[model samples]
Target: MASRRAAGRIVRGLGYTSAAAAVGGGVLYLSYRPRDIPGSEAAAVPPPTYGEGGIFRPPSFPNVKTRAEQIADLKRSSGTVSGAVEKAQSGITSLLKGDANDVQESNQGGKDEPYDLLVIGGGATGTGIALDAATRGLRVAMVDRDDFASGTSSKSTKLVHGGVRYLEKAVFELDYNQYKLVKEALRERRYFLDTAPHLSSWLPIMIPVDKWWKAPYFWAGTKAYDFLAGSENIESSYFLTKSKALDAFPMLKKSGLVGALVYYDGAHNDSRMNVSLAMTAALYGATIVNHVEITGLEKDADGRLI
Candidate 1:
C-alpha cells in the first residue's frame, strides 16, 4: 500500500509539470504573436512579386536615376578624378579595336629622337621585355610576325611547376645549381599565381607510389619541394591511403599499389596570360603591332643596325 501511494505521488507530480509547461508555452506564443498596429493598415506594404526569370522585382520609386545617369552625376561631382577612368576606358577601347596605325602614330618619335627599344617578336619573352621597358619609362616598340601568343606561347602544357624532376636530379647528383634553379622557379611560380590570380591557380598533382618502399621516398621528395618553396608554398604535401587514391583515380593500376603522394603546383591559361601581358605592355606606353616581319638588317657606319 505504501509503494502504491508513492507511485501515485509520482504520477501526480508529472501531471502538474506537464500542465505548467503547456501553460508557459501558450503564454509565450501569445506574447510574441504578430499583430497589426492601430493605424498601419492603410500603409501596409504589398507582397513582393516575382518578375520574369523568377527574380524578385521590388517596386520602383519615382525619379530613380539610371546607371549611366548616376555615373555622369558622379563624374560631374568628382571633377578631375574621372580623368583616370576615362583614360582606362580609352585604353580598353584601343586594346579591343587593335588599331595598329594609331599605335604606330602615337609611338613615332621626332627626327632626332629614336625608340629606346624595338622588340622583334611579340612572343612571351619579347612581350615581357616590352612591358618591363615600358614600365621603366622607356620608349618601346614591339612587332610580331603573327598575333601575340599565337606561336609557341599558346602550345604550353599550362603547368607552372617548380621542376620536381630538377629537384630529384639535384638530390641524386648533389648539384647546387639545380637546387637553386628549383628554388627560383618555385618563387616565380608563386609570383605567377599572385600577379594574375584570375588566370592562374594552385593545382594538386598525384604521384602514385607503386612500391611500398617508394612511399617514403616520394613523401620526402614532396616535403622537400614544400621546404624549397618556403614561404611561397601554396599548400603542403600530403599522402593518401590506397583506398582513397583508388577512389580519386579509378583508372590507376591496382596491382602493387601503395597509395600516393600529392603536391601543389600552379596552372594558368598560357595564351590568355601572354595576351594580357602584351595588352598591359601596350597600355604602359609600349607600341605593339602584329603581322609584320623583318626580312633583313642594314648596319650604319657606326655598326648600328638601321
Candidate 2:
C-alpha cells in the first residue's frame, strides 16, 4: 500500500498517465518517465519540416498557434491527444456545415453574467440583432426559447426572394422594404451558396404565361429584378415556348402552362441555412443557446422598462 501511493506520487509529479497505469502493473513504462524523454526518443524526433519546405497545408480554419507549436504537441505523446484535437476540429467542419445536432436543450452558464447587451429573443431578427451587435465588438448575450430559428424564420419558404410577382404591380406600400429585402436576400444568398455549394444553388424559376404579350412584360420586369440583385443574379431572364418550358419542368401543367417565363431564384435547405446562420454567429465569437426561458426583465434606476 505504501509503494502504490509512492508510485502515484511519482507518476503524477512526472505528469504521465501511462506511468501511473504502469505502476498498477508493477512495471514503469519508460516513455512516460521524464528520464526517458532525453534519451533515444528525443533524438528520434525529426526536425520540423516547415524550415525544410515540406509540403503541408495550413490548418483548415481559425487557429492562432504556429506550425512549429502544433508539431511539437504531436511529439509529446501517442497520437491519442492529437487525434482528440483533430476530432474537436471535425466539429468545426460540422459547424460550418450547419449541423444543429449539437444544439443544447438547456444551458449551464451563470446568471448576472457580464454582458453589455442581453438580446431578448432568438428568432432571425433577434439573432441578427445579437450578431450585428457582437460583430461590432460589443459584449452581447442572446437567448432563445427553442433551437435557433424554431420560429417564423424556419418556416420561411427557403427563398431569398424579392417578390418578383409583386414588383410588376409596382406596389408602393413597402417599396423601400422590398428593395432592402431584395438586396440583402440576394447578398445573403450568395454568401450561403458560396460557402456551402453542396447544399445551396440557384434554381431556375419558370413562371408560366398564358398570353404572348405577357412574355415581354415579364422579361422586362424580371430583368429589372436581376439588376436590383446585382452580381447575385448570376444568370439572366428569358421567355420560353410551350415546348421549351415543358422540357424544364415535366410535371408542370402542359396545357394550362401555355409557355413559361423562366427566371432565376435562389433555393436552399431552410433549416440548414438557419443553422448555418447560427454557426456563423458562433464563428464570429458570439454566445448562443437554445431552449431557454425568459421569465422576467430588469429595470435600471432611470425607470426605463427592462
Candidate 3:
C-alpha cells in the first residue's frame, strides 16, 4: 500500500512539471514572435517599377552610348591619329629627301648654295656652335654619326655643379688656373640653369661632418663657396645640428657624427637637355641631322675644308 501511494505522488509530480513546461513555452512564443508596429506598413519600401519596355535601368544607363555612337567615335579618333601620323611622315620624308638632294648636287659639282658653317657632330658642343652661328646670321648645317646626345653628353653625372672640389684644390695649392676654372664653371652653371628652367633645378647637397673640428672647416668652405658664387648663388650654405643631420640623412653613422653642411647646386636631365639644345638650334635656322657618318674630309689645295 505504501509503494502504491509513492507511485501516485510521482505521477502527480510529472503531470505538474508538464503543465509548467507548456505554460513557459506559450509565454516565450508570445513574447519573442515578430510583431508589426502601427505605421510600419506605410514606412516599408515598395518594389521597383519596370517601365513600358519591361526592363530595369540604372540611373547611369541613359548616359551610356549606343553601339553605333561608339563606333562613330572610334572612327573619328582613328582618323585624327592617322592624319597626324601622315603629316609627321611627310615632314620627315621631305627633310631626308632634301638632305639627299643636297649631297647629290654637291657630288655632281652642281652650284648649290653653300652653308657658312657645317658642324660635324650633333653633341652639345657642336649643337651649341651651330646655334650660335645661326643666330649670328650664318648659314649652318649639323650632322651626327648617331642620334644627338647618344655619347658622353647623355652619360654625364647630370650635375651642373660649380666645381666645389676644384675650389678645394685652388685653396690648398693656391692654383690660379683651378680658381679661374671654378669661377667660369659657376658662371656657366648659372647661365645653364637660367636658360633651361624647365630642365634644371637647384639641388641641396650635404657633406657629413664626422669630426667635431671638421664641422667649422666644412661650414667655412661652403660659406666661401657661396661667396664665390656671389649674386649667382641659388641658395646660401647652412649648417645642420647633429640631430637634424640624422633626420636629413638617416643612413649616416650615428657614432662620431658631429653635424653636416648643406650647399646648393644645379642638376638637370643631361640627354634631354642636349636634345633640347639641338632642337633650339634647329629653330634658329640651323639644319640639324642625325645618323650621318663622316668617313673622310675633303680639303682644297689651299688646305681649306671643302
Q: Which candidate is the best by TM-score?
A: 1
lDDT of each: 0.72, 0.58, 0.69
**Model 3: runs farther than 4 Å from truth?**
1-111
Count residue pairs with overlapping backbones in model 2. 0
What tens digits encode model 2's per-residue C-alpha lDDT throughout 234-274? 66666677887788778777766657776777777777666
Of 2 and 3, the candidate ahead on TM-score is: 3
- Candidate 3, residues 1-306, lDDT tens digits: the string is 999999999999999999999987864554345544322344233567787789986433112233354233322321111132343344345445644333222211212434556678887788888766554444456778899999888999899988889999999999999999989888999998778877887788889889988976887788889899999985677777789899988999999998888888888899898888877665544566777777876666666556
Name model 2 segments beyond 4 Å from true.
Answer: 1-113, 169-184, 195-199, 304-306
User: Which clashing pairs does model 3 show?
Assistant: none
Compared with the true structure, model 2 gives a TM-score of 0.59
lDDT comparing candidate 2 with the true structure = 0.58
Give per-residue CA lDDT, model 1, range 218-250, as digits (tens).
Answer: 888999999999999856777777887999899
For candidate 3, the 10 contiguous residues with the lowest summed lDDT are 73-82
All predictions: root-mean-square deviation over Cα?
19.8, 32.2, 30.8
Q: Name the lDDT value of residue 27 in candidate 3.
A: 49
